[model samples]
Target: MVDVTYNSDLHFEHTLWTSELTFWGGELKSLENRLNELISHWTDKEVLTKLEHYLDEFNLQSNIVRDIQKSIQQHEINILDHTPNGSESMDIPRVKEHLKLRHKMEAQREIYGNLKKDFFLFSSENL
Candidate 1:
């Protein structure tokens, strides 16, 4: 019973993370397009440099989001495999792996949020 509950909770968490990351992936695409548009208007060396930096950061974040999404999907498969036959035996290593993924997701959210905030500030000041 406890194992079933834990599995359910983990599935729910993964679903939420997957949804949020998908939304963020689309946002990054939009931001990249906007940045490209801004790049055409800015000939100033310093502003151009800053725009390039943001573009790189956005690309990096997008990659991270994709990687994490893959990890989550793989982890879900692992959960299903381990729980086959409705066995009550919980895989300790898998549980630890889920915890690690949860931490990674939380850290990515904070880092990505900061990047967006900084990018917006730069855009506001330079545009």
Candidate 2:
């Protein structure tokens, strides 16, 4: 017999949190540049329209990330805010906001997939 368990002692540091924020900012910029390149290089109006839609969705994701970062910084919220030893009471605003962004990102990932497929089709059509 084997026993498997989960540990609730896992915690992240402030540096990790800040690093994540920085990563997201860079990621958004990269995505924006990619979309702009696609729009400028592709002559297909339909494909350009699709890319625009994806860019709009990407902007929404960027806004959500920025909002979360701002909220955390403004409130001085740390990664352990929702941890067992971190907060004495049921303070879970950070956790809730993170979960919300995660859900949005999950949906955004689907849009990204569609964008990739469209770009592939555009490439093949041009060739």
Candidate 3:
């Protein structure tokens, strides 16, 4: 009973995380488009260089989002596999894996948030 409750809670958390990642993916796309629009209005060498940097960072973050989403999906599958009957004991390793995923998601959010702030500042000044 306790194990089933634990698994249910963890599964729900993963579903939420998946939705958040999808939203981040969309935000990155929108930001990329804004960056592309800025490219036409700027011709300074340094500005172009900074734009390139932001684009690269956005690409990297997009990749990270996809990778984390995949990991979450796989982890969910592992959880389901371990609890096929819903009466089995909780998988400690899966719990640990979830914690690791949570950490990665936190770090990704912080890094991406800083990048967005920097990019917005740059765009505002350069636009």
Model 2 lDDT at residue 56: 88
Cα lDDT of model 1 by residue, 5-115, tens digit: 478788889999999999999999999999899899989999999999999999999999999999999999998888858664457888899999999999999999999
**Alpha-carbon deviation at 119 in model 3, angstroms:** 1.0
Show the colliding residue pairs in model 1.
none
> Would you give me the overall lDDT of model 3?
0.86
List the candidate numbers ranked by TM-score, top first.
Answer: 1, 3, 2
How well does model 1 score by local distance difference test? 0.91
Residue range 20-60, candidate 3, lDDT tens digits: 99999999999888888877778888998899899889989
Deviation of model 3 at 97, angstroms? 0.6
Candidate 2 colliding pairs: none
Clashes of 1: 0
Give candidates' CA RMSD values in order: 2.1, 6.2, 2.3
Local distance difference test scores for all models: 0.91, 0.59, 0.86
On residues 23-105, what C-alpha lDDT tens digit does candidate 2 reach at each position?
76687678788889888988978878877886887687677667655654543444444446644333456545555554554
Itemize residue pairs with steric clashes in candidate 3.
Answer: none
Question: What's the CA RMSD of model 1 in angstroms?
Answer: 2.1
Return whichever of 2 and 3 wins on lDDT.
3
| Candidate 2 similarity to native, TM-score | 0.52
Candidate 1: where are CA atoms >4 Å away?
Answer: 1-5
